[model samples]
Target: MTDDLDTPVLDNHLHLDPRHGRGIDAVEDFVHLGGTHLLVVNKPSWHLGVEPDEPADFRPVFEETIDAVDAATEVLPGRAWPVLGVHPGLISRLVDERGFEPEAARDLMQGGLEVASEFVADGEALALKSGRPHYEVSDAVWDASNAVTRRAFELGAALDCAVQLHTEATEDLTDLAAVAEEVGLDPATVVKHYAEGRLAGVTPSVMSEKDRLERAAESGEPFLMETDFVDDPEKPGMVLGPKTVPRRVRWLVENGHDEAVRRAHVETPAAVYGIDTEATLE
Candidate 1:
């Protein structure tokens, strides 16, 4: 096992579901592993077998995520930020299970994002989270998903907060950038979560892949690191463990790539998220 790095790393993305394992323990472990900060992305209600007939019904998921982030901050104060959104996958779930019409699903997603925008405006959240179009869905559904995601970008522009995007692998981001630009959001404000390979005009919050990390390092590109840790007791370490980002940073430092580690785990995330690394780690 790799030891933690001297410079604490920040996990740009992670999901700490209280319904699964111990949320507090997860936060403690992340902090102990030299993780200086993180963003908690909550699962949508459809995953929990709940179909929302009203926009207010989505409130619980957002509240739960906010509470989780608050709890994590209390455990490791100033290290947690809340990220809430209507995930793109939720649209498929709503249609497949709840029999929501395409337009209805789209409307619901738009409404949920409006609520997320409200959270940003009210200072309840630091940013909005949403995913781009899914390839598996039909063209109509894909169009709707893209439209909702565009709405998220619009909200982000108005609120001056970043938008964390969940997109498919090998996606062409030029169009997304154009969409955000059209909505008045700078391309840099769209963070591509679970990112693989380098992308232009958007910040790639990479999963903990050594080869990908090394490649990004070689280019000296600014990016963020994440474990994408889904704390599900059943699946255990689904994407990567809570300590993965710190260990990756330590590994990079040992391999004479400390500068890259610093850029990914410290510089990029702080700039994109508007966090003061010194104050956060203190």
Candidate 2:
């Protein structure tokens, strides 16, 4: 079943927060659909409804993320990878919803990211997920959000780990990369999550769209493919189904673009996360 596609997919972004869907079954189902690797992200304030005061407060969230990935790895072994961090959206939530002061929120977020960076250093997770300037917040919150996000990148640089970005749809990447470089983090390690358009230096984790996939394939751009499956039962398959990336890979192969599938699904993720695809499958 896994070899049917001949090019196994590495789902770079997925949420298995237990509150959203059947935890281990979703992973097994994704594996059955020809997915070989999964980067499971933890959503603290988003899914778990937790507020951050200090970095230690985020340890429980990171531990939960580790437990989820460990459970999946128990089922699928090396195929499960964890991505732990304070999601950018949480910045706004803390400021606006929880009535937290901007500085306090920023401090909490930075502390949480410090904890995530430790996990990355310990090899328990691959990346610290954070991004600049969630566009929907108020002006003050937006400014504070970008400040905290910048600190996360600096933490990544200090820890020598990758950072996964979640920002607006039309956000620019050059400025983000500049921030990364200024903080001593390599721009190449910064991944734009749920990306739609092309960028100059940053790597995008694209969804399964014919035009988007074709453009990425034709441009010879270095990018990874993902479904960004939220796995929420209420809005099941909202962004895309679990099999979306595998189906898109099949579509590409059928259309005589097998090499593109290999680059996007296999080579790129392996290089980015430094994981062995075959070892994961085994």
Candidate 2 stretches greater than 4 Å from native: none
So what's the TM-score on candidate 2? 0.92
TM-score for model 1?
0.93
Instruction: Write model 2 residue lDDT over 86-178, tens digit each, in one string.
Output: 887777778878889877877888888888888988989988898755476777777777787798789888887778888877535888888
Model 1: weakest 10-residue lDDT segment is 1-10
- Against the true structure, what is each candidate's TM-score? 0.93, 0.92
* lDDT (Cα) of model 1: 0.80
Q: By how many angstroms RMSD does model 2 differ from the true structure?
A: 1.9
The alpha-carbon root-mean-square deviation between model 1 and the true structure, to one decimal in Å, is: 1.9
Q: Give per-model CA RMSD.
A: 1.9, 1.9
Query: CA shift at 233, candidate 2, in angstroms?
Result: 2.4
Which candidate achieves the best TM-score against the true structure? 1
Model 1 over residues 1-282: C-alpha lDDT tens digits?
A: 223356756788888777766688887787776666778887666654557877777788888888888888887634688888888888887788789987888888989988888888998888889975545888778888888899899899999999999888853588889999999998887999888747776888888899878877887778888888877788785889887877778778889998887788668766787777656765
